[model samples]
Target: MVKDLKGVLAALDAQEPGSLLGLRETQWVDAKSGPYQLADHKAVEELTKDVAAFANGGGGVIVIGIATRPDHDEEVLAHIVGVDPAAVNVDQIRKLIRQRITPAPRGVRIGWSGADGERVLFIDVPAQAVDTLFVVPAPVGKPGSPRTDTVAVPMRDGDSTYWLPRSEIQQLLSAGVRALGMPTAQALIELVRHAVSEAGPGDGPRVGQGLPDREREMRVAYEQLAEAGLGQPAGEAWAQGSAALQDLHHERDGEPGWVLCLVVGCPPVVVAVPVWQAIVEAGRHAPGQSPLAAIGLPRPPAGTDTPWVIAADSRSVDVDGGSWGAGRMTCSGRGVWRWQPLPRFSLHQGRSAEIGTSGQTPALRLRAVVNLPWAEAGRLEISKPRRTLLEQQLPHSAVAGAVTMLSMRRGADLPAARWERGPFGNSARSVGYSCTIAGSHGGPALKASVRLALPTTMESTVVACADVLIEDAETWAAALGPGWETQLGFDEVQAVLLAAWETAAELLPDVVGDVAGLSWAAPPTTELRMTCEQPADNGVLPVLDEFVDLAPLGSNDGGPRSRMAVTIIAAPAMGRAERKSLLREALVRMAREFGYVDAEVDVV
Candidate 1:
């Protein structure tokens, strides 16, 4: 949470004396005399060991812009500069600590020193609950003790000094291995359960009977509970209400000994009695045959008396019925039954009924048929109502009917479309027929094929309907042209241009000029340079004669449309009006080529 150099300096200034000691009783003297020195790997490792030791014993602080006096000698200040604040690499240092330490400590604060603009790393290692020990790959030796390199270091008691001990050093290296065999709360419970289960029945203390050692028995019981999925060592609380009741089992009829019993609930007398009776009867129906046996409730022998009894004093009425004897009533005595006389009738005696009327005969026998071509496409048709209704009301467009028929004919020879006709005044009232076409490359072709019989009256309604097909082929082609060309390649661009030219020639003759066969070849590299045709020279010349600098519009790499503007010198032969007109035409053509509809052109 500490912020800039000012805050860190303030915090350091507020700390108690002797707290700013460096790795080995190192103290921060005046920055002007000797600034903090950046410790090398050996120094850092030693510092970290002292830090861990300090944390394990009690919390301590390490100040970077500080030096310590050795051998009870006060420092004659030496100016050893600290690490450059701008290049401390604090994250790398933190990562090193995490990788080196076992059960890495967190919450260490690092900051910069304000006085000398140097790196100040503060490691606040809190007091660990358990003893914290670190294994150093190499040792920091005594002042003159041959420097044999100690493998591990411990924070010596009372002093902020780090000492490499000969005996306890091995213990640090083996700490991680020793941690593996230590019993976790859950593991301990499992061990106790295993011990209890191994004890023979009636051989050890009876179930719930106090063991010779109460603590040992409780430990065993706790272990058993854990084995039954009730133990949570990492501090998850057990469920209290109905779960507690369900978990508890006590002895009822067996020799004052406990056996696990799974109790569901205590229901009302009436509900319990009937269920109990049904269970008994079901068991009696098939001796020793009951499904509840899986949950430890098996059917007793047929002649065995039911041990479970519905308590007489228990509530017996059905809660849902609102009456004590409501469940006992029969359907015949209830209000649901009724009687009525049947009308004497037979299909032979009945006259032929018209679908929409009570008539003896109808003109047409109609049947409704529905066909779904694709899983998502379907059409419903009422054959009987063909003459009754002119057109079927569809959920989507009237075109849906046509779409349905076309899909039906996909990948198959076109079937004769079905239709119905109603009589008109002189001719019959004609209901138009339609079918949907589906599949690639079939819509327009089918539409063209069907449009032939538009005015002709055909006996087959289906054939007449086919003639009315309308295809949006040109629209679809125009929309897909550019995309198809882009997918195909630049060669296709010319093809697309030709196609567009032809389409425009047909659709907008006013804008397109008389056709001269289109031809194109890639322009030369010299042509890529910006040039303007000079009427006086009878040739093209670079637009800018002088050194002209260009910058991107809006300081971007390119303008809004990747466009740039250039001004050309007025030619001697061409009038200003002629030059302006030529520029306008060129700009318009370029805009069209670039697919811009609202490009602006200016003459300067």
Candidate 2:
């Protein structure tokens, strides 16, 4: 079933290949259409990841020359476009392992899967002992160049390849240093090599090649932190900081006035970077133009002009007199970062933040708060659309790292499940993708029922597409893991919104961009959610059972159009007007796809 990696690898892997014409990608299996491009350093790094991740986990199969379908609800394997065993360069694959991964993996076997012409390659990676973590070099500059100073620890969690978070990498190195009884300063220097990548990605570390500049940055930051006497206790530092902040005021035109200030202590600034990264991503609307610029202070690293603290010297309120970028970005996306001001109180929208960092960590508080117009409102505030955008950006940010510790006001109103200090995020994005970068990782399931319906009369082509969608929905539902037998209730609102959003993304992309520009640039946050309604009278087994891909295909040949529902009881009900509009749009879009262009949705 493992065919092409191109488009064939669409849905999740089934127990075996289905008639869907492709092998689904799953936690244990992956498919690719071509061999790794070893010439490109990034590709080589990727190849290292390809072999290492599988070896790191339960061990899995990487099938070369299989095409995959991209746009399906399930993991759809396309065709088995085999590789030439004669042309296979086994040494090249082996060479990448030596160049990148540390302590080369043991007993990785490569074999041919099919006969000639339809030949494909399969590399079986055996699981490794879990004592020490594996390391790999990171790609830099153009495709083939290697970053001498930086390396990443790649792991296969579920089906995704992820770099350990920078903090974790630091911890690992420090632990290694401790085991060897090395000095703390040397450990710190080793950690310094791993600089911040993209904002919010938790991209472990960018180790220096023992470069002097790298060591100097770490040394200076640590020295400043020591000078502040922050290592002894965070309370004292916070007290001093808060006391100093009270006297601060923004200069309006020429007059002094109250202004919001975003204060964060550095050295341990990495802790706060993710939160700030989310804010940056939420506000980012264009390239080379960042919303943070409006704040006037530098973006993160606590005091740098950019997002990296390693490359740029961090500005400090104590030293340089201002804040800066937090200096890390593992990945970038509209969803990677976010802003949501909970309803007033949670402390009534008043501003407060918890401090994080070690004495060994750097100290240099960063402060920059703008928005003079609504400065009195207190705390940061953003729209629901922005919230949605943040939810879509960091699907894999949580992988292999503990990069966030969400600190909220004590009086804030939040669900009990979220009261714990853990990764800062919600039920969207990764939950569905519950969902992560890895394929069929069986992550915690986040369920939102969606019911799709079809009218009694439609062209076979439309019916076919609709059927494919339904089957795809069912396939996705099936992938959610065991105990999914629960029946999906009707959610009219979700159905409509689902259709409308899908059609809008396809048809009016520009319009959506013009409107929700920040969110439009983000990846698709909503997954296809559909469920069929169960009959009140369960005794009767209908005649056309095989035809029904979903709960109940909308209508019979001559009966009224079938109805489907979608609902998320946990979600607060939307406004009445918006719900009605969504229903109308869903109908209109579905009808148009089914050849009803003039159809004006009136599905109140």
Candidate 3:
């Protein structure tokens, strides 16, 4: 059973089994009366949409082989109809979803449960860490309409699934999630103190001189949050049904002035452990450390001497009629530890301006929950400096960098010299690099400073995970479609591969010799042309068109020793034996270059 299955079962139990129903269809539950044989394309498409919808929303369950009565009102229960055990093939459905959904929903749990002496399929879809909306391509055509090109954002609204509106899509696209900014009332007071201390002497009222100004500003901030419907800071007479009022009267110990509090509720986190593990494994350090390191941050040290995770507290509360949980995950190393909560910030204002100004975007509220483990690994550490250093000497410096290249042939034939003049050329090449500088931070505990060697790329784990997901086969296949072919068994592929080897051989002439005993029995045809038989109505002469034709080979596994196979179509003028000999010579030369070998030779 999935972790949330108990909750789902509880929901189902609320309705009696024989009361003309089973469980009412809600935003999170979908009841279908029959088994989905994914071999049926329509069934596959429907399943894809439902999965996408549940992933986009707060995650939900799809109960197949469950019947519902239309005559009943909102309380209608979808009773069990039972699935055909023989017809159920979990692998096929899993594969279909993997092939069709872009950035395919992670942590999708599918199982069979017995009910009413019959088996029903339960598909539990987990909400994504971020707004990773799945886009499934429309298949050929509808029953009554001709084929058309379109995209879909399947989302669940109320009790049904539909393509979400453009406005909603825009909102999801622009929505941002950060670890709740300040996790506690004390943290907020500390931040205020830090801000005031950081300000120059000429800035707004100092702590003691700006007493009235501070009070007025605090009141204004409170009113702004109240007017925006975030609720009054706990103790106001107008406050009603406020359960999260623990910090209503919270204030800095030394500062007696009034203060405004604005709290925004956030979404519950859905942890997908396997996906999280994959991301961490793909990273450079410990099992789950790379996701954080890649984004220009240091991974917390882990071992027998250090704990992998330390959570201080966790709890759920009702806010603005929505239930949101706030919890902390801390990682410590070298006498430094940082706390990151589900609703990360205890108090934060989102504005691209100075802190004291009224630049806060009250109209725009932000909220997000951090997935456990993976997100836990990404919270920034707060270092405790033991000493201070004011050295006059320059520090030793070193540059760290890495580069990865994915090279491939583009055209069907050997490049025409003319192709070089065309913009972008014919061959395709992509390069990625990660570069960082080594630096040092020195200070005492009072300065709260420590040595720092950080990456220039400072992105959240959620963003970094999304980057890593791009390399996943399911994600790439779904995004590019089945027709995406990277390898073609054309002469051009061989040419490119050989050219690279030849260049390498130049630097190691002693190691690589000329195609030792191989000789061209017949000069290979480097170019082929086809001429049209007739001219157009303009009466122009017949013209010959040069074309590059290469048969698509299979995908490259992206390993250094992976073999590259090339197919060479012999010229029509060549004899069978001659073609075979030419093929043998080419294969031998390729082997000598340690590139690609000729797999086959075909003569028309």
Q: Judge candidate 3 against the unseen true structure and give its global Cα lDDT, from 0 to 1.
A: 0.34
TM-score of each: 0.23, 0.28, 0.28
lDDT of 3 by residue, 42-97 (tens): 77778888888888787887877678776445534456677777778875676556
Look at candidate 3 and give me any clashing residue pairs.
22-77, 179-344, 180-344, 180-345, 181-344, 181-345, 182-345, 182-346, 183-346
- Put the candidates in lDDT order, highest first: 2, 3, 1
Residue 553's lDDT in candidate 3: 22
Backbone Cα, N, C clashes tallied per candidate: 24, 87, 9
* lDDT comparing candidate 1 with the true structure: 0.29
Give the per-residue lDDT of model 1 (tens digit) for 374-479: 1000011223343233233221222233333333323234433333231211122223333333224443322211110101222111111112121333332333
Best by lDDT: 2
| Per-model lDDT | 0.29, 0.35, 0.34
Q: Model 3 misses residue 425 by how many Å?
A: 86
